[model samples]
Target: MPTGNTVSDGVGAFQSREQIILKDKKQLDCENAQDDDNDGHYKATHPTSYMDTMLHLFRGNIGSGLLAMGDAFRNGGIIFAPIMTAVLGVICVHAQHILLNCSEEMYRETKRPKPPGFADTVSLVFAHGPVKLRFLAPTMRAVVNAFLCITQLGFCCIYIVFIANNVKMIADQYGITIDLSIHMIFVIIPVLISCMIRNLKFLTPLSMIANVMMAVGVGVVLYEAAQDLPSIQERTFLASWQQLPLYFGTAIYAFEGIGLVLPLKNEMRKPELFQKPLGVLNVGMAVVGCIFISMGFLGYLKWGEDVAGSMTLNLPRGQILSSVVQALIALAMLFTYPLQFYVPMSITWPGLRKRFGPKALVAKELGYRAIMVMLTFVLAQSIPELGLFISIVGAVSSTTLALMFPPIIQLVHEGHRNRLTKYIVIKDCLILLLGALVFTTGTYESLSAIIKFFRKES
Candidate 1:
């Protein structure tokens, strides 16, 4: 989930035809596993149970992004961070519901036994949507997939930056003087091999290891952050207006797991159980939100304005426990690298198939993998700010994908059915505006900070 391409794959170490989403698995896995039955409906050979779906939902939504909650609180202040996080959490969950409902509506309308992936749903919604929007189906699909590529690759960039930042901090503890950029360059070794990994099956074990490491790492981080904390009055309840958007970007990126919802629900043994008042998605997200709120509150209370991009990096230096957490988190990101890389690689690689010709998929993919992996490393080296980098991706891409699109799709779908209500328009419009605001302000502040930092660093 932390490494989620939201593509949510490869040949040699770098090629997969499989569509493995960070919902933990690709929607294609479930779809491809089922055969067309006599009733014309598709069913999974081994569908996931309610609890299973809940676990997937939890794993998919929360990951490295949660690690930044402390920094986000630094930006938003204490009281407002939790309050706004709760509000945004509810909106994010509602967006997921909107996406799921739209996809199900498409299935019922078209009588398609198979449930569509997120991008497919966008295309189909447009195709069957209002007359003006029907012509935009292909365009919409490409747009959705394009953002998927951007977001997933963006996640990869953040991973590289995060790994480099923490590892460099640990290296500093031992009087090691390797520059941050050098650490990122060294990352090229394993990331290339991992990205070249051709099979999703192989990544499963690596991903499991990452999950375990992250669990331990996050637990250690939270435990340490909660200790020797300052009084509530020490930190502002509301931060400066300019910094609030960074908080929005951070929180949205952490919560925007809407991409995982449809894919998870589609593969469930009882899909209806997914959208109930007490559904898997709701309960899981609720718990994750509480964790995020707690982490932000505690981390900020502990470190105040000085918290690092990741709380793990803020642990007291020279302690074995602190160093262990840093190492675990770094290793966790490394293992998950391949899964995130394959997402955008899968989406864009197909478009280049004709250029490379059919016979060259393997060689072509090998070259492509090298280029994409390097690109992520390059981007990370350039920006080199973990918390701000995460905010930029969340602002520019995640917000659009998670917030902007759902409302638009809902409007189009509802309009297609002649059920478009004024309240619906008003509600969704407000959400879209909120997303736009975050995108604009967050992008401005993050980019400005990076530029200023580069001027000083260089």
Candidate 2:
């Protein structure tokens, strides 16, 4: 049976023997500790510097999901796309800050290590100090973890699928028919790589690869935009009213993964030194947004919405350039899968640690890794693929996590003072309402699209 820290021996079968002893000591000490409010000594070890933390957070934010930007741009339109994306970025930044502040407060007041659920922990902190959380605490906490789980797991699958699709893209350039089984290879390859490693440090180079590709990819798009400058008046002014929505929607997708940056502050060695990761988030998101939209606006101007997967594929078919772009894009996808997987893994870590002994934890972790591989396998094999499912998930969950959570967290942290409450609460209510509307509408549209496609198939 699982105790507070010491899990069953069978659980640690895959963990190294040393790991078993260390984890046992850690768990035993934690469980036996008397201070419920003091989170103990974990925070003191290995604090990351602010700049390093920011870099890590920035990469973590985008993960693999930005690959879907071209597809979202295919649907939302160019004019409103950047604007909406900026708005979402602002909301995400504010919400993330609020979550962190609440997390810090909970640590201070409750003396609890960060609560298990993001929202729950915040609500508990708020509820403790004269805020009548009565029902909202548990509701918000459940919402946070549930949606977070879906987003994390779904993102992992999304990246794996992208990897498979990217590999197929490469195969096509070589005059080979890509195997349908290529999808399974992507899943298995990454899972094996990630599972064998002991720390995330091994994946840092991959993160750098992702950052470089994102930068180069954006630069290429901006270059394309420069080429279209002469026709900008015509394209910008006279682009059809009908095309606008598609452009904007797609641009929003480019900016969707901003939430991945949140945990860095607490994880950092000197979280206080960096001010907050918000500045990094804002700058990174802006750079990413501009490059993505410019690519879409220019690529759409040059190649139109029919561009699949990435705008890079539409580059003039020169052997060296085409092969390089495809390889880079594939590497970007490979880098992305782990970044996305890390989020869920963080959430899953506690459960895995408790259920299995440290020694066997490696195998259980691999088992979890296997589950993600299976999910990717299923998604890739499903005929008549769809792009909007990612958006639907993003719009719905991100909306709640981004737009609603911030103000709610703030309200919890600082008790409701009627005068200030009226203004802030009302504004947040509207923001939340708008987010809900967009998410619901987007979900309905995606579902309808799926149904229509399946009906035709039938």
Best by lDDT: 1
Model 1 residue runs over 4 Å out of place are 1-41
TM per prediction: 0.93, 0.75
Deviation from native of the Cα of residue 163 in model 2, angstroms: 1.9
Worst 10 residues of 2 by lDDT: 1-10
Candidate 1 lDDT by residue in tens digits, 211-306: 778889989998988788778999989999889988988888888677777767767788888899998888888997898899989989999988
- Tell me the spans in candidate 2 whose CA falls farther than 4 Å from its real position: 1-54, 63-65, 111-132, 135-139, 179-193, 196-202, 208-230, 233-253, 256-262, 267-289, 349-365, 383-386, 415-420, 455-458
Pick by TM-score: which candidate is best? 1
